[model samples]
Target: MFRGLSAFPLTPVDEDGVDLTAYAALVARLAGAGVDSIGALGSTGGYAYLTREQRARVAEAAVDAASGTPVMVGIGALRTRDVLALAEDAQNAGAAAVLLAPLTYQPLGDDEVFGLYEDVTHHLSVPLCVYDNPATTHVRFSDELHARIAALPHIGSVKIPGVPTGAEDRVAALRALLPASVALGVSGDWTAVRGLNSGCDVWYSVLGGTFPRTALALTRAAQSGHADHANDLSDALEPLWALFRRHGSLRVMAAAASHLGLTGEVNLPRPLRGLDAEQRREVVAVLDALGLDE
Candidate 1:
């Protein structure tokens, strides 16, 4: 069920609160675009910045807006208890699944990470996807830990961040260890095509959420064995991906959405600024080049 393009949309917000209207529009746009799944509150959604109440609202809006598309909510918290409560919220809000990251203030060993998933699995009625994003969580999952987590009851899939080096070999190694039933998804926009070719079953995509048509086209080309077409599409998206690498994707994406008038002025949480004038100009150039500014 968690295959193909799983669009991870940003939570459009202003000082007032989460912009459910814009948020719902974004979700509806993705669903109408034939995206395979919807993942609200993944890294791009700025899940970490919101309060529990805010997160609950976002999940509810996402599920309702998705209109029967499978909506997955990112349920990451520093505390396991908090994770459980968030998972319960996702369930109540009618999310299809919950994505759990081993978010920790201190480094967590494999045992601690495994215990976290084990506890969450017990509480959740829906399937869980293990989100292995070390960049935000500060905890990396080893192959052993991935296998152990996949073996747990109700555990469904794994969302892997891009493998910076030796992606094919590493993905192949993980695929070998994981059960055939377990789905493997790749995030990290730049490496998505490579990961899909390497054997990832799905993509947890940021770009796809904002611009579903482009991302879905690339995924379709790659999955259908059109390597040249897929590579060319990835190459075309490199400029936007470059901004994502330099300025951080969430900030840049919000700015892009606002520029396109897809969503009005996206207000991130305090202390984190959006793009500057120069960066905004660059985003405009990329969007125009991609014909996305219309």
Candidate 2:
């Protein structure tokens, strides 16, 4: 379940909270497209912003809409107790696994972060994926810290941040530290090809959530050892990647999903607005140019 394309869909929302119909459509689309797993409440899904009741509803909705595709729900929260509660909610909703980032307001030491995982993992019934997204979570996981966490029971995967050019050695070193049972997954939509070609086991993707076939093509190409094809596919999406770099992926993807009519115009949570009209026009132009508007 952890190995292949794990598509993280947006949790479409408005003033009414989660638009379960649209959210379910997104999950069902990815499932029909044959993604390896559906990641329901990752960063892309705006898990941090949703209430526990809302998150529980989202988890249940995702599993139900998955059509038997493995579903992994994000269970991150500020406190360890809340995290445990979220984990239970995910398990009760029938999640195959749970993704956890060290969501924090105060800066945390390595020991504190390690303790967080240790406490959560001790009571988790489902497998856990250690989400190492320092860019958002602000708590970076050193190789040693990762090794410690990966040793804990139920640590099925580690979703490492982007792999830069020529990062094979870095990936290899981390791989050597982890147990063979722990899959090394990659995040960062733009760097996924490089990560996969460098022997990462999975791509926990934002792109795949909305553009499953396109992302799947790239994923399959890399997994099949077709480096040239994978590189070409990634290169073709340079314009989209540029947009992602300019505006954060959450905003860009929200724009894409909105423009495509997959979700409502006011999809994002308050204070986090979607792209302005001008930027959205640019997104549309890029989509048309890339022949992705279809």
Candidate 3:
């Protein structure tokens, strides 16, 4: 369940609290595309912005819409108590696994971070993926820290940020620290090809959420050792990657999904606006140029 392409769909929302209809449609689309797993409430899913009840509903909706494809729900929260609650909700909702990042308000020490995992894992009935997303969570995981956490029960996978292109050594070094049972998945859509080719076990993808076919092609090509073909596939989507680099994957994907009529015009939560008209026009052009809209 932890390996291969794990598509993280955006949790589309509007004036109505949790847009379950639209969000479920997105998950159904991903499952229909045959992604290895569906990751709900991940960063791209706007998990951080949602309330506990909203997230619980999203988790239930994703599992229902996934059509038996393994669903991994994000259970990250600033407080360990909330994380535990979210984890329980996800497990009860039939999530195959839970993704937890050490979400922070004040800076957390390594011990505090490890303790958070220890506390949650002790009560978890399902597997947990350690989400090492420094860009959003502000809490970074050292190799030693990761080793410590992965040793805990229920630690099934570790989702690391993008491995630099051609940085096989980095992946190898991290893999060496993890238990053989713990899968190493990569995030950051732009670096997926490099990360996969470098020997990561899974792609925890933002792009896969909205563009599963394109992302899957790239993932399969790399996983099959067709390095040149994978690179070519990634190059073909360079414009989209550029947009992701420029405007962030969350916003670009929300815009692209809206353009594709997969979700509403105002899908993001409050304080987070979708791209303006001009940026969206650029996205459309890129989608058209790459034949991604087809």
Candidate 4:
């Protein structure tokens, strides 16, 4: 189930809210191009920005566009009950699963992390995938936390960030303890092959957002033991990554969307920041070179 290309599509909103046409077109484009799954409200969708009620409405829109594809909703609220409520909303919207991120800030003890999982999983029937984007979430999935989540009956697994530097040996040690059923994958492309080679069972990515065809190609190549071929596309995708590495991805992506008329307001939450005119132009240039502009 965690095998193919999965995209995290942005939530298309305007001053009036919810641009169904833009949202539908994006979903239809990706689904038609062979993206195996779709995740709404993931980092790509600016999940943390939307209020709970707004997220519910946006999620409902996603489920309709999902059309039976494995739609995963990012359920990342600071509070446990609200997270569980979003998971319920995901289920209600027919989402295939909910992507849960651990509570951020205010450090959590091991027991607290496990308890959070137990609380959310209590009301969930669909599978739950944990997101370990520690840059924002602030807590890494320590080995003990991984073990606890894997033991849970409903958590399918996690989308952990790239393994930490100097942690390769530790990952080799850790992999032995992780169950095959609880798979792991990172979120970027150049790193994706490494992740897959490192025994991550799936590839959940934002690269899939603009380049689903290329992303699926990469996944197929890796799965077929053609990692070198995947590497070639990763090279082609380097410019996109460069945009992300230099400034930021989510903001650059919003600018790209505005450039393409996908959304009117390319806004990030307060203090998240955006690229200026010069930086935006550079991003558009890269996208233009990639033939990504609409």
For model 2, what is the alpha-carbon lDDT of residue 94? 97
- State candidate 3's TM-score: 0.98
lDDT of each: 0.88, 0.94, 0.92, 0.75
Comparing 1 and 3 by TM-score, which wins?
3
Strongest candidate by lDDT? 2
TM-score ranking from best candidate downward? 2, 3, 1, 4
lDDT, candidate 4, at 53: 83
Worst 10 residues of 1 by lDDT: 264-273
For model 1, the stretches where C-alpha displacement exceeds 4 angstroms are none
Residue-level lDDT of model 2, residues 146-167, one tens digit each, is 9999999999999998887776
Q: Write the per-residue lDDT of candidate 1 for residues 1-294, one digit (tens) a residue.
A: 678899998887766778888889999989999899999998888888889999999999999989999999999999999999999999999999999888888888889999999999999899899999888888878899999999998888999988667879988898899888889999899988888877788989989878999899999887888878888999888888898999888888888888877787755765667888888898898888878753
TM-scores, all candidates, are 0.97, 0.99, 0.98, 0.91
**Candidate 4 residue pairs in clash (backbone atoms < 3 Å):** none
Error of 3 at 76 (Å): 0.7
Across 168-238, the per-residue lDDT of candidate 3 in tens digits comes to 98899998999999999999888888889988899999999998998899999999999999989988888
Better of 1 and 4 by lDDT: 1
Error of 2 at 110 (Å): 0.6
